[model samples]
Target: MTANPTATEPTLLSLPAPDEWPHWMGARGDAQLAEARRLVDDLKAQRPSEARQVLRVWNDAQTALSNAASIASLFSEVHPDRDVRERAENLMQDVQKLDTDLGLDTELFAVFADLDDTDLDADASRVLEHTLRDFRRSGVDRDEATRARLRELSEQAILLSQEFSKNIREDVRSIRVRPEQLAGMPQDWVEAHPVDEEGLVTVTTDYPDVIPFRTFAHDADARRELVTQFLTIAWPANDAVLQKLFAVRREHASLLGYATWADYDAEVKMIGAGQAIGEFIDRITALSGERAERDKAVLLERLQQDRPDATDIDGADATYYAELVRKEQHAVDAQRVRTYFPFEAVRQGLLDVTGRLFGLEWTPVSQEAAGTWHADVATYDVARDGERIGRIHLDLHPRDGKYKHAAQFDLVRGVRGVQLPEGVLVCNFNRGLMEHDEVVTLFHEFGHLVHHVVGGDQEWVRFSGVATEWDFVEAPSQMLEEWAWDADVLATFARNEAGETIPADLVAAMREADDFGKGYDARTQMFYAALSYDFHVHETPDLTERLRELMGRYSVFPYIAGTHMQCHFGHLDGYSSAYYTYMWSLVIAKDMFSAFDRNDLFDPEVARAYRDKVLAQGGRRDAADLVADFLGRPYTFDAYAAWLAE
Candidate 1:
């Protein structure tokens, strides 16, 4: 029963209170923080005979605290106001410390500690099991001295992560280029970038600018300069932060009796050990090296033919040369393809595909009073058979102080009778039409929004949302990327401003061209995953060697001298040792797609099974089980291997 229950539907709950941005965030955060504390106190004060009731209160408090922290932290990451960001950061610190305190609270742990695990249902049992696990992990079972030290380490680790992200967010580096340097770029993009007083155009490292300049700019020196600015983003400042952050993680993991941070994180993921992750990376290296080298030689041949002065290519030369090779050899120019897939069309295509497959509809609603942080933000009501399933927010453009990457933020996670699930998909793409790959990226991120909000709707916050083991979290979204390649789906959304649909022949041509550079892309990710893994295994991260070594082995091109990619590699901030998850999740994603392809690409039966079993289930069950249930078979790497072979 909601506070404002209607006769028609109880689940059609009231909108969020205070109901607007800025004010609502702080007020809601503070109020929820208070309520959560009250709830926790109530739980601790309860008698052991009232275990069920106490557990209920604990669950409520868990959700409340989560909501409070989310509101505060969202602003800290995406708010344009620095003052709001600073205050939100402090608020997050306070909330996190409170969380640590509660997790370590002996009385809090004792509330449901003695309950017979067999007495509860599967969901409740899992929730209780997780609750106690978190408590134990927080040093609830340790002595007072050890508990204090653990708290200190938790604070330090979190604060360091916050700082690391802050640096990247504040990194507003840009390169000014002459109009001559931007020849062959898309028209809409060229028009968007107005020249300054000196007649030079400013190109930020935003994907919209960097990707275009690298993919279209014929000038090697210009692309090289832009790549340099991009590679060194927030350097020296971020460099020192990353170094200390490594030591803190090592200490934090060591205190937990783990040899490395990789070990600690792996304890909860689908893959069991740090060694297993390494072996996975090594397996990919073995499978991909020959193909990646062949692709590199092709690019090297182009480089030598075009720029006789260059014996080999560098990181700067990779994108530009690859684009050149793509055009000359495959008759596929990414910029040319972008003309067909505008942002609106691509977005509509995603909506269309989801509507068909999931038996759903999306209606645009004014979220103005909802206090959208930006004018570009749009809210949509997601419905199935005219009953609202949930809401989704799309913040699809780049702006200052926004999270500088493409991701889905589960702003409000679904919990039966408490609150509705809402998510925002944030990405930095051209305000105009996107390249084929950019469309794929959008579909991928939105896939996350759906997975986060719809897939994980359990009553308990701890049991809800995309809590799947980290390595498997990307699978659903990765599966969505396959939709981008489907000719039927592409025809639906791949339209120009004139409303001419993309030709089927072109789609086939583009698909063929797509695989030409995929080997290099795989190798690049392997480099990143390997580098991230090494950062954790050592006492101190010799990022210099790791970058050089991995770049040599996994990169399709040679590295540039005096340039450090790690300084700007924000993966070090949060992903840390888990960068391998991209490839890991990709394998599962490909497997899931293969199952879908075996039926129809837009098969309603497949979509329903996926939603009920995989997406909607969230982390309620093991990811492997969810996948198996959907596929009607056990998991295998065969689909991924087959895709790579093609």
Candidate 2:
């Protein structure tokens, strides 16, 4: 995947620097906004050539600003400093303005619309086309007044999103539990975080701390308190943030001349329309609902078997009892699973899989040389055939100031001939809890990494690497998750540091448990997607009330009172009305995986075809076109539904 030296190296201005904090972020933002203004002025003066130069300058500046903002924002989420967060927010606002000034809908499209396809080289044409399509979707074609309003709303939405995430990051709730109450938890977890003077083991809402307590803590009251605290993140303040964000998004969409937020947002997505997505959701819900009901019945029965007098199962009992079900049905102990899949082995497994599938090599870089946000973070030089392709940083473990979620940040987007484009994949998975399933999480994030590193063939920087349809971008990463589950793939990485392979029976047990409670998992995801879409689509005064009403209808479990779940839902800001992308992308991912199943799971010929036809192409062609080309046929939902049966 490494580019030839003759290929353009990505501009240095576009790359993110590690040590430069708030000031670099501010300067980057100013540069981008200044470039955008230059472009506007050039166009107004009727200087076409100067206008084009200005556009290129703006693109480069925007890319750098965006990369810096993403890194700083992620850092502040974990670190929780007010200044860093505010700087990140300010930079984000500058980006939104560029999007508006350039015509969120039309400016991008205009770049491609007037291009003489043959005049520019292939790379330039691809970039131009990508930018054009992006503008079209962003409402660049809207009237001047509407476009102005859209820009304002866009800026407001960014501010609201940052506030929403900040509120959650700053929220720390404490609960007291006796030493005995933590009985079922692993001793390491309890010792790692102990409360002061109250005998309470304080656990934050961070996944590493929260998940284990939910899954293992023996005391019902203690579990209830933690679960409540986890769910109630961002609370009343976040609720207002979410409502404002939704309203801003809706207003932005309406100004762009769409009937609803969903309609406007779906225009550039794979589904193409709100109705199609709604239909897809309806079908999946029907199919999955039956399985979910049966799964819940068996689980509830098992719960009763354990605690005979327990009448109702609520939020706190969900994970604890689910663990019981997993052990009872599959004999797969989470702790035992962790013993085999150590952190280093999982990391090696991910690198190994990418090497095999994409003909790429990853050499670890020193922390001092890489200049990252934290000591634990590592950078890797991605190369192919002895040539540098791109670079990516893997911030794997949870840290104090790191974002408490797994996400891929596009630090420096690739433009053809641009050398050393950079990206970072930030995740908060437990290094200690190295369960077999955690391997899947690693592969999933690596999927995003592969997309960013491999697809630098686009002419325009904007269209480079996983910058396709918003809904379709997840497919490449989602497809990687399948490899993690395959035993053949696991054999390559699922070994001890001492080089002993994990037991076959143990692997089998984990696979069984992987399928266990999948129905419940699907339903839970559906609930979140439904809630996200409903929040954006509804045009009502009381956002909280509407959310409750929708939850009552869509959620299988009863909604807990006094908790504002939407407040902490980060995706609501950007993915509003489009959170269903997860499920939507799964359909395409499953279809793509079917190709490997047919040719050969590890077949180099098939892998090469994918690398050449899909990964190498970036967002130059329509996402569906790439999928169809790679699969040698149109994508269908059959394979996706069939996977659920397995």
Question: TM-score of each candidate?
Answer: 0.95, 0.90
Backbone atom clashes (below 3 Å) for every candidate: 4, 22
TM-score of 1: 0.95
In terms of lDDT, model 1 sits at 0.78
RMSD of each: 2.6, 3.9
The lDDT values for all models are 0.78, 0.71
lDDT of 2 at 101: 59
| Per-residue lDDT of model 1, residues 304-398, tens digit only | 99777777777788877888887888887777688898788778778989778777788888754454666787888787778776778788888
